[model samples]
Target: MLLERDNRLEQPDSFYAGLIAAHDGLSLEQSADLNFRLLLILANQIGRHDVLQAAIAAAREGVTA
Candidate 1:
């Protein structure tokens, strides 16, 4: 269960380009806010507690200082 939609983003290449385009000229805070909003939307769409938990764990698997 990936931390993403089953359909993923259609035309991934274009979506990637669009994401970059959206961030262009944004301040760091703006970019972070955009990311936060997108994450919430995607997370809601994912809608499986176990999958979300696993994905969160996997994402943090190597984080440390």
Candidate 2:
């Protein structure tokens, strides 16, 4: 699977809304923990070492740069 920009979600609005709603009423620490847990869960589901590493590097670079 290519890891570039794409519009693959069928229900983007609901998905984004749900994601935002998941963080509702949480402090920064709680929100960060929730996001990390969610990332681990989804990353495990992907289950590809190279893709996961590439994704992690790409995401980390964006923030640090």
Candidate 3:
């Protein structure tokens, strides 16, 4: 399976808003932790190693340290 690159969310704006809202009142550390936990949960749900690797590579495509 391939990592989906297209917008598949039914309510993309709403999902984005909700994701941002989830960090409300969180400290920097807490927000980072929340994001990691969410990523783990979602990755587990999509349990294919190759797909996850593709997603990781895609996410890092234009990112710099």
Candidate 4:
């Protein structure tokens, strides 16, 4: 899910920390669902709508780029 962080890829440590907090006790599906909700909350809290949109667009743009 690094692709979902766009230019913010420079901050993997914080991302992984959040992911770990969100997924520490769940199954794969639960982890995914929780992570999704958590990301939404975080983006909203940070007022980072464009960043999120860019991240999603980047993901669709390609895995290699």
Candidate 5:
């Protein structure tokens, strides 16, 4: 289970980096839509709504920190 968890978490940073890069070309509405879709994908893969929420909240906090 732990191995599965670790492997699941081990997806390439470049994947998200690519998403961020792609986001740069988007209009505000398009960017918001893309981010929502990406969050849904991530939440499904990670399998925990609270974990997803916490991660997102933490990331937001980090950005402002």
Candidate 6:
């Protein structure tokens, strides 16, 4: 399956707020850890190597080291 590129959330603002809220009290390292864990959880739900790879490439598009 191809990675979805559209906004699929029922309430995008609320979800964004909640995601930001989740790191409200976290240190930088803790926030990074939270993001890593969240990525793993969502990736597991996706459960497709090709789709995950596509998503990663899409996410990295225009991003520089």
lDDT of each: 0.85, 0.91, 0.93, 0.72, 0.73, 0.93
Each prediction's TM-score versus the true structure: 0.76, 0.87, 0.86, 0.51, 0.50, 0.87
Superposition TM-score, candidate 4 onto the true structure: 0.51
**What are the per-residue Cα lDDT tens digits for candidate 4 across 1-65?**
43343465667899778768867879999978886898688778767667677776776778764
Q: Mark the 10 consecutive residues where model 1 has the least summed lDDT.
A: 1-10
Task: Point out the higher-scoring one by lDDT: 4 or 6.
Answer: 6
Model 2 residue 37 lDDT score: 100
Q: Clashing residue pairs, candidate 2?
A: none
In model 3, the runs with Cα more than 4 Å from the true position are: none
lDDT of 2 at 31: 100
Candidate 2 local lDDT, 1-65, one digit each (tens): 54757887899999999999999999999999999999999999999899888898888988965
Q: In candidate 4, residue 18 scores what lDDT?
A: 77
Residues 1-65 of candidate 1: C-alpha lDDT, one tens digit per residue: 45554665669899899989989999999999999999899889888989988888977887874
Q: Which residue pairs in candidate 5 collide? A: none
What local lDDT does model 6 show for residue 45? 95
lDDT of 6 by residue, 1-65 (tens): 49666889999999999999999989999999999999999999999899999989988996988
Predicted candidate 3 versus true structure: per-residue lDDT over 10-52, tens digit per residue: 9999999999999999999999999999999999999999999
* The 10-residue segment with the lowest total lDDT in model 6: 1-10
lDDT of 6 at 25: 89
Worst 10-residue lDDT window for candidate 2 reads: 1-10
